[model samples]
Target chain A: MQIVLAIVIGAAFGAVLDRIGATNPTVISGMLTLRRIRLMKTILLAIGTGSILMFAGQMAGLVDVGHMSVKTAYVGVFIGGLLLGAGWAASGYCPGTGVCAAASGRKDALFFVAGGLLGAAAYMATYPAWKASGLLDGIAGGKVTLGAVPGSKFDGLFAISGDLLGIVLGAVFVLVAFVLPDNLTGGKTPAEVPAE
Target chain B: MTLDWKLGGVLLGLVFFAAVLLVKPIGVSTQFVILNGIVTDVVNPEFITQTDEGYTSTNAYMAKSNGKYAKNAANPVNYSFIFVLAMMAGAALSAFGRGLDREDKRLPAIWKANFGDTPWKRYAVAFLGGFIVLYGARLAGGCTSGHMMSGMMQTALSGYIFAAGAFLAAIPTAMMLYKEG
Candidate 1:
């Protein structure tokens, strides 16, 4: 039953990703280059909406903060994030979107998926070495919010309330999503801009 | 037809909400790890169990039966894996419905425009990049969807920090790779 639900939910999410141009490598790479802003707006808007819903749901008891799997803060996490970013820029596909693109019948995306799997396999093969390297050690707050805020039910880095801060930040993202131009340089449709 | 991004974003947010309501948070990287576990277990069950250290520890989620690496389809991690399959099906459905798969060329035009026409180079870079991203994601404990999107939604500090780091590197990397011709 749960697997069925997961399939439905995943399908809906995938459809959304495709519709928003996320399945397109050009759109992703273009956003990184600041040549296209549509994907950026989409991402920001999604994050904003998600933030509002999640935090608001928590306040309303509709969502459980404990259910969310929060990652620990560590030096390696930051460095790894940088590497992930560089990889995304170079490959034009993150893990999620790569699968989506492949499903959309892009052969290049298939290669990307194969590469990702191989890469992951390599990582697994060397898991012990990485573990011993101390890069994965040194966790900073295991699960934190903003500012180590007080009177807050959730963990954070700041002294502000988690819900309040999340909602405010979400609103800001929504605003920015609306404010950014759909296309930075303009005039060409997304499809027309690439591979004529 | 492509739905507007704002609407798509809203729908995606709703999906996240639904995921939280029904199961654990949404993420993609762990599925790969689970796959790795399956592969390794098949190749040599003793490989992962040889050293009970770090992630490879016997009690680790991937090594245990009821854990993320469970071969059972009903397992939660496997459910996440199923979710990835479902995502692909969803994208394929959308593409077919929209005639997106009708295009003859598989290679992205932007890549060719910038890097010239060499399939080998493109594939090589793609494989290397994919490997690095997965490696980094494992080190970081998540990817954009896991750490940045869902993490931020939960107001986790690591999410924001990871987001900052991702953009800090991504923007510059794109600039360096795809300069104006």
Candidate 2:
């Protein structure tokens, strides 16, 4: 039953990803470079809207707090995130987008998938070393939220209601999305600018 | 035809929201690991073993979670794995819906402007980028979708921090790589 639902939901997610220009490396790199920010604005809007809906849903009992999965806070997580960002800018595809792009018939994306598999395999081979380095150790209370939510098993860093905090932050993101200019560089993208 | 970016974004938000509300938070990278395990297990034939207590892997990473990862790799037909596959199918469906005559079919315009029109070069870059991104994702225990998008939505502090770290490096790296336009 869940598997069938996964197909429906996953399909919708991929379709949305494709439609948003996420499957295009050009759009991604453009956003990263601040040359073109239509995609970034879209991203911000999506996240903000999602956050508002999710947090509000939780509060309204429409969403389950128990299903909330909080990743362990670790130093490696931060470091890995930095690495992923660099990769994202260079390749213009994250894992999900890469897969979607490949399916969308971007031949380069197939190579990306191959490389990703190899990378994951490499991580598996070296997992013990990372584990030994203690980088995976949870920091600041292993799994925690910024604000406290009533039903979740995780702790909150602050006493404020997490649901409300989420709503506020979400709103802020939406505001930023609305206010942000199309291009931080105040010029057309490289493709449109023409070679000098 | 492609949807407007803002509309697409809202739809994305709704899709993510619906997934979380109905099931578990959406994740993709872990499936990469599971795929690796499945391939390795197939090759070695002894990489994973189904025991009296479920499943276990020769690799410690897979052995964690009481062999939960091992189980996924061994079984290979569960919800998460299917979700990832379905994601691909959905993307293909979307592309087909777009008529395959979309602009930037082979190479997007901006990528060509900066990197030139070499398909192999783009492929190499894409490969390297995918490699590094997945490595980092595994290291961080999540990727953009898992940590940044879903995590922030749930208001997890790690999510916020990961987003900060990602942009911190992403922006500079992007600037360094493509100084044109």
**After superposition, which runs of candidate 1 have C-alpha atoms over 4 Å from their true positions?**
A147-154, A183-196, B47-77, B101-105
- Lowest summed-lDDT stretch of 10 residues in model 1 chain B? B50-59
Considering only N, C-alpha and C atoms within 3 Å, which residue pairs clash in candidate 1? A145-A155, A145-A156, A145-A157, A146-A156, A146-A157, A146-A158, A147-A156, A147-A157, A147-A158, A148-A157
Q: Model 2, B73-166: lDDT tens per residue?
A: 9988898999989999998898787665454666656567677878788888889999999999999999999999888877887887788889
What are the runs in model 2 whose C-alpha is more than 4 Å off? A188-196, B101-103
Winning model by DockQ: 2
Q: What TM-score does prediction 2 earn? A: 0.95
Global Cα RMSD, each model: 3.8, 2.4
Total clashing pairs for each candidate: 10, 0
Cα lDDT, model 1, residue A121: 68
Q: Pick the candidate with the highest lDDT.
A: 2
The C-alpha TM-scores of every prediction are 0.87, 0.95
Residue range with the least summed lDDT across 10 consecutive positions in model 1 chain A: A187-196
